[model samples]
Target: MKRIGIMVVAAFIGGAAAIGGYKLLEPKGGDALSFQEQQNVLFASNPKVASTGAVDFVEAAASVSPAVVHIKTSYTGNSSNQRGGSPFDMFEDFFGGGGRGMQRAPRAASGSGVILTPDGYIVTNNHVVDKADKIEVILSDRRKVSAKVIGKDPNTDLALIKVEATNLPVVKMGNSDNVQIGEWVLAVGFPLDLQTTVTAGIISAKARSIGILGRSQQQPTEEEYEEYQRTGKMPTNNSIESYIQTDAAINPGNSGGALVNANGELIGINAAIASQTGTNVGYGFAIPVNLAKKILDDFRKYGAVKRGYIGVTFAALDADEAEKLKIDDITGLYVTDVVPGSGAEAAGLRKGDIIKKVGGATIYDSPDLQEKIGRMSPGDKVQLTYLRDGQLKNTNVTLKGENSVASTLKPAVAKNTNKATIDKLGASFAPASAQLKTRYRVQNGVVVTGIEQGKLFDSWEIPKGVLITSINGKPVNSSKDVEDALPATRNGMTRISGVGPEGAFTFNIN
Candidate 1:
């Protein structure tokens, strides 16, 4: 019995020593079991966790969805339907078009808009409500109200419309100039006729010009001219697309919708999609809210876009061009020509000069400069920085009005001659002289003598002395013919053919 008790004691001693050794060899925190328990206790008491990199767009979506509205437009049938089969024919058929007689029901189309004010001032794409006989805004609560277009600026593709509603939801505008790449954003719109949809994406790029907006002094390619002839769809005229490009899913009905940041602030107006299928293909473009805001302000104050022009024609500087011009950096716009008696010329900006900055913002390309000047009004002074002969120079330029030169040069016309107006065509025309017709080899045409600063003529780069020979295949012998061919209330596309210094050319104006 003594020996057995001694053996049991020895065994207990050995087990205790083994346990103590294990404890001594364990990690600093604790034994495996105790470490896990400690972790559980810590977690329970603290409860803080690391982020998983997931974004929650619910707040943004909710906040912006209420301010976005569904815009439905109706178009009446008349000579505007000259192209018997129309693009909206299918839509009209689906929505029930006008009756079999001349008094047909108005064809309907739908898009989206953003409410800008509480008393019912709304902002939307020009294409959305352009030429519509009636526009109706359907709010988030499904209350439909008739709206009227107050003003439109085709250069920026923005329109201001008003409704008779009170206490409406308005979106908080954000500074798009501060929007960063890869930042989270939400596109709120009625895409594909679906009820308001909110899609999230990150900004893919900035200061993108897709050539959808025709460049100044840019001649259309053969393919573009043929495509317009075949489709009867005009390219965007005086279109400004210094767009904030994104990968968001923007479809047909997304036009004129709101592009909100993660804070639910409006940063852009969803406009065009770069898709071959006429649907979202991961690439979408929006007019920056800053540009849109400028347009809105001008519309409110001047009843039109009070645009400021520097009167310089330029092109993007390439490496070769930069080298040829002895420029070390190809970061500025290469000034090919400067208009005489204009702000640029007055400021001593000459051809071969490279504009480096305007109003302190770095000028990266033509669109950047265009956007900067476009946002300012006549008589506004801008600080200009340019590289002249490889030397950096600075000057201040006071801008002039669109018709400043015309007002100075042209002779006073009789009341009868002034009877004809160009309407929204944004150009002034006169009967071409015999010498101009002989020089251009055109028998009959009208001369585009002057243009508005930010209008169709300027956007199309229709320079003065160019002869407009035809419109929509109809011969234009005088200003009246041109005016008649392009009626003020006409809708859809227009084919404008003219001859310039570059020879015969055509423009498809929308």
Candidate 2:
């Protein structure tokens, strides 16, 4: 009887030990794991290993395709008036559209998205879901669900959306700052209205700005222009276009898809393709995931992008730009003007100062500065290195919210009068003739008689012969009129309204 009791006790103790071991060693529930940990766990369980010797993308493609979803969007009313579709869809007429002003039909568009969270958070392009009436998400397991836009930012061409589902596969977000040129990567999406497809390519470039986002937004109007002149407030487009350029075969339906590294980590959200034929033509652009993370978090928290501004107007300085601006320095950004009540003003950043660096990264071009600032929010502090009078100085600038008021940033205008103004314009002006006025449909104006190659007008691409109807809200029929209207406002911004080949337009020069 004593031997029997001892055996039973020993068995019970062994059973308890085994149960404890299982509880401690087993993987945690999906909800309890971080994205990186979850992704690591997933790949660990898979038997196939990605080959590193000869550029095999089998493992990455398989891991990413499941998280990349097919997104179909429906637009009500006229398709011409709506804004949902590929950015290249504007070129549809050049490709397949019968002609302009043809009978329009309601449009149904399809794109792609990457699942960022298991509970249905997804990241896509703003153009993919902007003004979409209904969004339907199709999962890899052949399950269909509805999705709604949480927030959409046209500046960065990014949108955060959510679906009403759980246990969805997610793509791990990777550090795009570490993505090197010529590195092999994969593009995963549903392209050409086909099933999930994967393509491989190399990173062609980084910090590329194609100016697509600016073209996609509504053009400035005369009223907005007039308001800017009257109030000394510049009309802000704030379009951020820093993209990771790749040679991946991204097509029309691939917008908002995943551009993943060899580790199957999400690095970019594929946005645009540089093709006039409305198809892939070797160049494809993706919004870097580094810039998208802040935007996505803002969407989840604030339901809008809380974009911060440095409160300065700057031009990326190259050899040609420096020559146009009549500056000696060929690198860094030349500060043209500073906005009043801006953080830049408080930080004592003046016009003529060249911004050399942001944080510690060198500012080689607009994208370098734009992308870094684009990732930060209002009230965030940033360190800037600038060159002033041949002296390099540093300052900490606390970014201001769009509506926050602070210091007064004086405009960068020459103390000298009209001669400096005309020189700054870099274009000779003449009184508009009756024929020119009639052609441009303007009441009174001056013509861009001639443009100096290395001047502001030429650099801005303001073509010769375009009618300049007004300057700083004053009707300019002659050069004398323009000279008198120069620097009219205390804020020191010059607003120009005119008719160009593209029709009525307005712009501000600081």
Candidate 3:
């Protein structure tokens, strides 16, 4: 009986040990400490857990999603014959010429837009509804309405459209100038026909020029010009682009959509994307809201954009070019040529001068300068800081209107009586008669009696009967003034103003 009691006591001890092992090994809360207590104990022992936080886009998405809208455009496709030849002919050439041309259906495209006013004024990219025969806007609430284009500025790629609706959801405008690099941004648009998509990214860069505006002042090659003629989509020669670069996923349908900050304020208008597969490959660009605001204001006041021009051809300074120019830093544009009589020239900005700043804003490159000046109107006075001969200079320039020749200067008579022909200018000039000056109501000027073929004047389409009033903003009374006024450099650009057969004309010569 004592041996049996010892075995039973041993078995009882074994069962207790097994129960304790299971309690210790099993998950917390199974007769053991709670999970929270276990975590506290582990944390107390180690004291090193990651503390990363997540960015919640819910609030931003909620605020902006209602303001973003889907845009649908419809246009009649150009007939095959209108494209230079019928597609049936090409197919018949491969087979036999018995097939007739087939009629193409109307072309339809989709994009996105942002409401800018509570009264249903919308802003979008110009390319979105460039030639749309009909434009339809689908609001987030699924209300369909027809919209009409108010105004479009091709240079800035912005368009204003209006719908006959009231109390529309409008996006809050943010100061794009305050947007910082690496700041969180949200792109709200209808992408891939999906219900209002919101994409998150950071501002990768600012004041970026992607050459959507043609980079060179020279004439494009035959191929380039032909392609532009065929596609009708080449960047304008004087188009201004100061893009905000981001890594956001902006696809085709996202064009004209709102790019907002974390606070859900509109900062940019999604305009373009860099892609090889005809879709977003990460890189995207937006038009700065500040620039857009200027255009919008102009559109509201004027029937079209009243763009300001500085009248200077400039090149972006690089490290090597800076060293060559003896500049300490490559932070400003190097003025290659100041158009004669332009605001730049009037402000004493000489060729080879470095434009350091405009209106207190630092000029980093050509696009920066372009954006600053393009946003201003004619007759606006701007402060300019430039570097010339290693000395910094400041000047105030009164900008001129687009047609300054007819409005600004009085005609002057030639001092020299000799009638001379300028081979470089490709025109022969004679002093204007007093009767001719009286008829033209000019104080003094010269008349072009002859023009040579294959000359600048010929290329400008200036006929022999035109009067030469000024070259490069300088009043020219004689052929000598014309010859001396022409810059010695071949590649230099000049603006020649005179009265042609039609009216006062200004020609930009390179």
lDDT of 1 by residue, 1-510 (tens): 999999888767765564455345445423232212322332232222211233777867887899999999877766252222322222222223334322343477788999876557788887677778889999988999999987887567788888888767667777788888888888999988899999988899998887653432144334534443343222223346698999988877888999988777788998777764556678888999888877886665556887776766666787987788676777889887665567888989998888899989998877788777777788999999998876899999988776552232223211125535476667777675433343344567876656778888788777655668998888887668887787532367788888754568988889
Candidate 2 runs further than 4 Å off: 1-54, 83-105, 221-235, 405-510
RMSD of each: 19.4, 11.5, 19.6
Q: Write out the backbone clash pairs for model 1.
A: 98-105
Supply the TM-score for candidate 3: 0.63
The per-residue C-alpha lDDT of model 1 at residue 57 equals 76
* Candidate order, lDDT descending: 2, 1, 3
Per-residue lDDT tens digits for candidate 3, residues 1-510, read 999999888767765564444345545322243222322332232222111122677866897899899999876676332211221111122222233334453377678999875557788888777767889999978999999987887678888888888656667677788888888888989877787999989899999887643422123334533443343222225578889988878876788899988777788999877654546667788999878887876665564787766766566898987888676768788886554567867878887888898999888887788878787888898998988777889999887765552222213222235667787778887665443443444566776756789987888777665667888777877788888888743358787887643456788787
lDDT of 3 at 135: 96
Q: What value does the lDDT take at residue 109 in candidate 2?
A: 78
Higher-scoring candidate on TM-score, 1 or 3:
1
Better structure of 1 and 3 per lDDT: 1
Of 1 and 2, the candidate ranking higher by TM-score: 2
List candidate 3 segments past 4 Å from native: 1-54, 79-106, 215-236, 323-329, 405-510
Model 2, 210-241: lDDT tens per residue? 76666544354455434433443323467887
Best by lDDT: 2
Candidate 3: minimum summed lDDT over ten consecutive residues — where? 83-92
Candidate 1 — what's its lDDT?
A: 0.70
lDDT of each: 0.70, 0.75, 0.69
